[model samples]
Target: MGAFLLAWDPGGALAARIGVVNVQQVLTQSVAGKEATQNLEKEKVRLQGLLRGKKEELDKFAKEAQNLQLEIEQKGAIWREEERTRKTTDLRRRQRDLAREQDEMKRLLEESQRDLTERQRQAVTQIVKELRDIVHQLGRDDKFDLILDSTASGVLFATPSSNITEKVLQLYDRKKKK
Candidate 1:
């Protein structure tokens, strides 16, 4: 009963209405090449370095706090309880200051990363629109029934004859050159 309900309803009819392209390959090789890849990598490295430096500062603060804790433990017994309490309060204040700085740094880093991602997404979206236009023109020229992006769909095994990625890239490159 389950198999009967799940049987193919459209069969060969749906196959006639679809075509596919590897947009990932098209964008990598055609739209943004080695230069764009390198620039993005350099930007990533710079951002990482900034974050690392901030983390190092935080680590240093943690180390100072740890040292103060040790000092308090050693001096805690020798001093009057009120004197020990005052030193502990001072140490706690320092820790709170460091924690606030670390939190602000983390928030800024997250916001910067989000901004970079949004900008990259916008640039990719614009490039994809241009590629789509090129592909649509080619589809019209070839009278294709439909066009699909194999990369977006996670299609691993498309026949070379059926794939139009290279052709679209060629047209897109030519258009760019002109």
Candidate 2:
């Protein structure tokens, strides 16, 4: 009760061939991966420097402010009554400025993280699409029913002959050259 077409279906052989192509290597070694890693490293270094500078500035300010407070405390109750209002105002101002600086740094860091994630996602999606297209072509050429990604599939082991890591890398390199 099954209908058969006149053309032959080489699904098994084609799927095996595509599997051997190993598109994961192609994506991992591609330019996108290199660029994403490079940019992320650069951002990481820049952020570290920014954090160090901010922390040092805050520490210096805190030390100087503490010394000023101690000087006022030691000077005695007579001068304290005279300058209490001005001292409180100055302390509140310093606290507010420090808080603002901390908040700004945190916001910038969060923005950088978001940007990095978006860039990585974009690069990955582009590479995956390219690999899928190549795999689809191979499948068409060989008449495969399905070409499964071993990484996303329930595959435990594949024989050396079944691995297409090198082939996909070569193809990727060729495409990059073009």
Estimate, for each residue in 1-178, the C-alpha lDDT of model 1 and write its tens digit.
8775555465643334456888888778884543456666787788888888988888898889889889999989999989999989989987998989888888979987897788677667877898889888887888887788997887777777779888888887778778
Which runs in model 1 stand beyond 4 Å of their true positions?
Answer: 1-19, 31-36, 80-86, 153-158
Clash totals, every prediction:
0, 1
Write out the backbone clash pairs for model 2.
20-164
Query: Tens digit of lDDT per residue, candidate 2, span 11-31?
Result: 643222435444555666766
What TM-score does candidate 1 reach? 0.74
State in Å the error of residue 154, model 2: 2.2
